[model samples]
Target: MSSPDATPGASSAIGSALYQLATRAVRRLPRDLSLTSAATLATLDKTGPRRVTDLAAHEGVTQPAMTVLVRALEESGLVERRGDVSDKRVTLVCLTEDGASYVRARRQAGVEAFQRLIDQLTEDEVRALAAALPALRRLDTLDGQKREGTRP
Candidate 1:
């Protein structure tokens, strides 16, 4: 096994690789979809309907910014605003079927791109990546916690 001290450059190397991959993947997406909009759709698809204020908080944007995003998405028929049943004054944003399908297609495209790259790896490397997926997911969660200034 590699000693922790001996791997001083490894973290930076991995970070650089991830950044490059993400940049390339984003470039591969449809020009019509801004990254922020795509992210909002993905979040809504994963988390279900939420109040506009809640989405603003989650996305770290002002309410006005989120409202603009929602409006654009609404115009595209990707999202719909529904009056909250419990509180008629509150409007919640939910993904339409089209939105869900769009998000899924985007996700699949990203996965396919990554899979194409991963296919070049050796069998052992692929197995290692498979084994590391859970840890990588945990790391993602930890990163999110750090961003939110919360303990992991």
Candidate 2:
């Protein structure tokens, strides 16, 4: 069920606000890897191994670009390409233990940063944010569905 005010304009406004907040927050974080690299690592951490072409499509980059990124990651010992068990000819990119650690640390940093900001909010504002948590989680679920091509 949709909210009464869930019109196109409202959706656009929400998207813009969320995008601005996310980009600004991420920009403030200290990181060794580029945003795209971090994102690719996070994806691998979440979904396990995937094909290079799939990663490229998911990341909106060219196959060659993904190949280069994967190469760099491999050199850093962050990811490894292994043959797919079902099909030995296909190689799947899998995240390394170090890569998972990096992802966890980065996520923890982000959580801590948000926690500090959240602590400064008033009781009412905090309550409002808490109330919105379910909706925010649902948005994340929707994004996953879209990515898996399961959305109607």
On lDDT, the candidate that comes out on top is 2
Per-residue lDDT tens digits for candidate 2, residues 60-129, read 8899999999999999999999999999899999999998998999999899888999999999999999
* Residue pairs in candidate 2 whose N, alpha carbon or C atoms collide under 3 angstroms: none
User: Which consecutive 10 residues in model 2 have the weakest lDDT in total?
Assistant: 1-10
Assess the local accuracy of residue 113 in candidate 1 as a C-alpha lDDT between 0 and 100. 88
State every prediction's TM-score relative to the real structure.
0.86, 0.90
Q: Per-residue lDDT tens digits of candidate 1, residues 29-58?
A: 888788888988988997789998888888
lDDT comparing candidate 1 with the true structure: 0.88
Deviation in Å, model 2, residue 137 alpha carbon: 0.7
For model 2, the stretches where C-alpha displacement exceeds 4 angstroms are 5-13
CA RMSD for every model? 2.8, 2.0
